[model samples]
Target: MPHTLAYIPTPAPATPFAVGETVEVLDREHVVLSVQTIKKVTRKKVKTDCGREWMLDGEWFDGESSYPFPSIRRKA
Candidate 1:
């Protein structure tokens, strides 16, 4: 038997962010945390102007593929 890593995509939808792009951070209740531009972006990290970061390739998930802290969204 072979081992296969399962990654069932989270039901929550989050917008992937890029460097120099503005985004809004929201709490579990969808309350805004902060609105700022991305300082740095990578598969392991996404740093914001406010010094907040989330590590994930697709939106807001950590190395463990779990969503930690605030979620993100495009600036309106």
Candidate 2:
């Protein structure tokens, strides 16, 4: 006899950002330039007047994935 394991599907995590929202980036304040949907995936574009910019995805901030980019937080 062979043993089998059950498979389950999980819901995608929610994003903590919104378009045109200001968030703290790299200890500084930045604005979310845009939120684009590409092939069913979400992408957030952030930038500062000093020319600091980045395009972030779920894996960058989600707990289940590796986070290698600067931390982002809601403006106080």
Top candidate when judged by TM-score against the true structure? 1
Model 1: what TM-score?
Answer: 0.58
Q: Candidates' lDDT values, in order?
A: 0.63, 0.38
State how far residue 36 of model 2 sits from its true place (Å): 16
19-54: candidate 2 lDDT, tens digit per residue: 555554431122343333222213454443334443
TM-score of 2: 0.30
The number of clashing residue pairs in each candidate reads 0, 0
Clashing pairs in 2: none
The residue ranges of model 1 lying beyond 4 angstroms of the native Cα positions read 1-15, 57-68
